[model samples]
Target: MTKLIGALDQGTTSTRFVIFDDTGAIVTFHQIEFEQHYPHPGWVEHDPFELLDSCRLCIEHAVNKLIKLGYQVSDIEGIGITNQRETTIAWDKKTGQPLYPAIVWSDVRTQNTVDQLSKKSPKGVDALRSICGLPLTTYFSAIKLRWLLDHVPAVAQAREHDRLVFSTVDSWLIFHLTGGLENDGVFVTDVTNASRTMLMDIHSLSWSNESIRFFGFEGIELPQIKSSSCIYGHIKQGALTGFAIAGCLGDQQAALVGQKCFETGTAKNTYGTGCFMLFNLGDAIPPVLSHNGLLTTVAYQLGKDQRPVYALEGSVAVGGSSINWLRDNMHLISDHHQLNELAASVEDTGGVYFVTAFGGLFAPYWKVDARGTICGLTQYTTRAHLARATLEAACYQSKAVLDAMNKDSGTPLRALNVDGGMSNSDLCMQIQANLLGDGVLVTRPKMRETTALGSAIAAGLALGVWKDLNDLDKVNKEGETVFRSQLSAESTERLYSGWQKAVTRSLDWAEPVDEKLE
Candidate 1:
């Protein structure tokens, strides 16, 4: 019988399912986009049920396609999950229903609470950042968790009843897929996912006692901490029945693993709705650096006894999402893909620079109130110019992350492993190389769904279907497009300085700025 690997990719925008054959080629796949909830300005959320349904639909659709092609359902060996890292969900453990909407990673509802906590703490914000490699920012899950417990009535009720359970999306899915806490299976999260929660000790790779106490949570409410590559549980029933639930990691970590970046100094950048750059920093817990908002987090832990891997992450709140804003909010383009073509048409941005600060600046800035801005606009500014500027903005934002990683780690990066939708654009990859003044390695996946492939890598290892990362790396393809920088340091630095100035103006401008696209 042939072997197959299955993965559930639960992202901020949607869920995807994929089946990879023994050679690591994708046999069948499905995807579904789900609804997002924005209760107020600076807030982002999702209905847990809607999120789950999207996964269910994707799984059924993808598997059914393979079955029609004469693939046996029993060929699936293990299931792995990769999810949006910081979205928090509170639910009733017994009834298995969410008490409130899932608070998305991008939401800033807890900014005020974060402020109060920083003021009261002795070492202030710097102290916490030292401990977690994350600043006292509202983008993290801890502040969001605190806010929901305080403001949401149902959440408060369940907490009082000892029936409330909390998790980022990964834990929620595991509970439901494994028949919930009532059915004997319990809640747990992988080290990569747990590190982003802020409630976990980044050094120890466990839930922090001080953090839980600070959040005002008592005993028995927390979930177990598990390795990224281990058997989590089994799906008692679903389209994927009897399959061992083998692997789980946050979306970004999965991307890192999918690229097989096991060695330190290797990194991967995902240019999805947002751009997130992560570097494997080995297991050292370096002290937080000055002013940069970079997060020191768990890259992934293979097992309980294995030494945990660490990483530094830099995130840009809007990447491809800015292109969507151009289409949906400004009506500048008929199709979003026009961005790639339109950008390619322009030799340059023609003096224009777009600061895609839609949800504020993350990693190296940590400011929550920043707004988007398009600078150096003139009568010459056409759609092509703006499109070029948008692409440049994504590259520029990632460059800032690379700069921060250098500061935090003390060694400059030699090259970057790039993936995600934007990485497909050769022009964007060239711009990325020019700005970073380093080589950009673009791995065009045999499967475009690398997020799903990553999950399979993790899950397969845990189920003993795959032995180690070396086993996954054997199937991990090696073909890549390499963009080496030819630009002088003087030229690169000059352009980066201009990008910084444009971002300065974009900050805290909650209202619109007038600049006609002629």
Candidate 2:
């Protein structure tokens, strides 16, 4: 019997299922995009049922194709999951029904709640950072979970009944797919996802009692923290029923593992709806280092025996999302793929800069007051210039994050493993390489579905598809596209300085006005 591993990649905007053979080659795949709801300004949400249904549809669709390709259902040994982190979900323990829409990672609706908690903290806003290695920001899961429990009626009822189960996307999917609450469902989250919640201790790799108490989640039952690469349970239903549900990791960490950044000092930047640049920090808890306000998070843990890997993450709230805004809101381009062409049509942004803080700035600048801004624009500017500026926005943000990572780790990154939607644009990759300057190479894997592949690798490890990390290196040895710096150091530094000025202009532009008087 041939062996294969399945990877379910549940993301912010879409759900994807991919199947990989023993050699790590993608055999087949399917993707389905779901609706993203913005009920209020700065708020984002997704239907939990929609997310779960899409995964099932993708799995059924993809596996049928795999079967048609001569692989039998019995040939598949396990499944792994990689998902968007910090998206909070709460459901009933007995009924397995979601109480509220999944609060997306980028949603800032809980900013007021975050502020209240921060003000009440004895050590101020930085108090949580000491224990969780995360600042008091809306980016973490804890604030969103609190908002749901306090505001949502069903969630409140579940809490009152002591029947609430709070989980990230991975856990919710796992619980439902593995028999739900009725038959010993696996209500667990991997360490990588748990580390992003701000309710888990970074040093101990477990739920922090202080955080749970501080957040007032005493009655809520959180998922058990598990290693990224272990069998959580078996799929009880669906086309791929009876398969072991093995590996699980937050998307960015899965990208890190997929990029094979097994050693410290290695890094990867994922250009998804939001951008994340994760610098692998190995197992060292490096004193809550905050370079430009970068977040410290768990990278992954393969198994129970191995120590968890840590990472310094620089998050940009907008990446491909900015491009979406251009297409959907601004109507500047009819299609997303047209961005590369439109951008390449121009020599530069014509001194224009776009500060894409559509949902406020994250990482290094945690400037919640900032809003999206376009500066240095004049009659001379065209959509082409705007397109170029849009792509440059991502590159500039990446440069800023990279600078912070280098400063914090004291180890300069020599290369970057790039993935996600925007990475497909050669123009964007070239601009990224140019901005970062010499000695920095931007690499894209031949198998661009690396996030799913990373999860598949983890699942494969448990089933003995591959013995260890050493075996993975030989799995997909395809050639990668390398982008080298083409700009002079002087020019790169000057352009980067302009970006700094643009970022400064965007800050403090949209502070929330208080209407209620104390």
Candidate 3:
């Protein structure tokens, strides 16, 4: 009987359950996408119940397939979870019902609330950034939690009755899957997820009292903070009952761990709906590290014994989402896979550059007023030219983040481990390689689902399925494809410089845009 690990990946757009053998190969896998709601401009949400149901279905389906393949349910040594971080949900502690829709990380409905709060703080809005390593922005759970407390009637009612339980998506799923309120469900979140809420002290690795007071969220029952890798609890009942539920990381951090970025300066870019570039900073939090626009966060905490590993992260608010807009909105590309072909049809963008500041630009800029802009459009520009420019937009944004990471860390990245949907496009990857300039290599794993595998690795380590980090080296040893810069430094600079000009034009395009904070 070969033991296996189950990884539950709760992402922004979908939920996936993947079963992995000890060697990190996928035994079986299943994924189900959930609804993404936009009630208003700059607002995004997910039905909490739908998120839970999707996980259940994925798990059941994956386990059934595993059984047909002759693997016993008991062969699952543990279950690991990686989730979209900072998607806030306030639920009834007793009934297990959400008070409001889960506020997604990308939702910027709280921009006005952020502005109001910033004015009240001493260092203006950035007062808390020093403590939380995040700017006062709508991208975190703290302000979203504050907004729900201030606005939602049901959430306020739940709070009055002492039934309000606050959680990120990871905690929400863990609580329900481990028996909800009936079996005294585990009320906890991993440090990686908690770190994104802007409510945790990175150094102490606990909920910050000052932040709680600042947000006026003193009474809600927040989840206990746990290390990224450890047995938080067991599955109370399910297809795989009594399986130890160990290992939990926020999705990007899971990618970092899955990519085996154990040493400082190792980095990876996850080009999902948005892009996140995490440069590992090891155990010590550097004193002089610049938090300017970039965020500092927990990369992972493998066990209680190991100190929490940290990373300097630069987030691009629009990555593959721009590609999504092209397919669904513009109707230019019929499918995502066809995008590469369209992009490759053109020699260049015909001097066009796209600044995909859909909601606003994150990382290194933090320009909340920026909106999408396409510059240098001319008579000769075709759909293929626009397609090439769109791919360039994603790559250029990543390059800006990479440059910032190098400046802050004082060490340049030699290579980047890349994953997610856009990494599948060879043309896009080549563009990324070209724009990133010389001496940097972009590598993609054969099994692109590294986020799920990272969680599985964490769970396996906890249950002794794998002895240590080194023991799992051969897990995903299938050959990898690597891309290096083909463009000269002078040409890369000229192109990226034009991208900067396009970005500047997009800024403040929607200033005084009414914020629906009330």
The predictions' CA RMSDs to the true structure, in order, are 4.0, 2.0, 1.5
Q: Can you tell me which runs of candidate 1 are displaced by over 4 Å?
A: 285-291, 438-448, 510-518
* Candidate 1 residue-wise lDDT, 1-518, digit = tens: 66898999999887889888766788888989888776677678899989877877888898899899998888888788999989988888768888888999987667777777788678776546655666677777877777887778888889888888878889888877886656766488888888887778877777788777766777537678899888888876668866778889899988888877788888888888899888888875553444566877888887667788888889988888788789988998877678889998988898899988777888777766687888999999998999999999999989988888888777677768777778888888888988887444444554446677778888877766777667765675755567877688898999999999988887876543111111
Put down candidate 2 lDDT per residue, 1-518, tens digits, no spaces. 55789999999889999998877789999999999998777888999999999999999999999989987888889999999899998889878888888999998877777778988878776878878889888888998888887777789898889999888999999988998777777889999999999899988989999999999999789989999999999999888888998899999999998889999899999998888999988887653457468988889999889888889999999999999898989898998778888899988999999999988998888988889999999999999999999999999999999999999999999999999999999999999999999989999987788899889988988788888998887776677899999999999999999999999999887656331212
Report the lDDT tens digits of candidate 3 across residue range 257-353. Answer: 8888888999999999999999998898642346456888889999998888889999998888888899988999998877888889889999999
Deviation from native of the Cα of residue 238 in model 3, angstroms: 2.7
What TM-score goes with each of the models? 0.94, 0.97, 0.97
Tell me the lDDT of candidate 1.
0.80
- Local distance difference test scores for all models: 0.80, 0.89, 0.89
Clashing residue pairs for model 1: 247-459, 293-364
Model 3 residue 458 lDDT score: 89
Show the colliding residue pairs in model 3: none
Clashes of each: 2, 1, 0
Model 2, global lDDT:
0.89
Provide the lDDT at 274 for model 1. 91
TM match of model 1 to true structure: 0.94
- Ranked by TM-score from best down, the candidates are 3, 2, 1
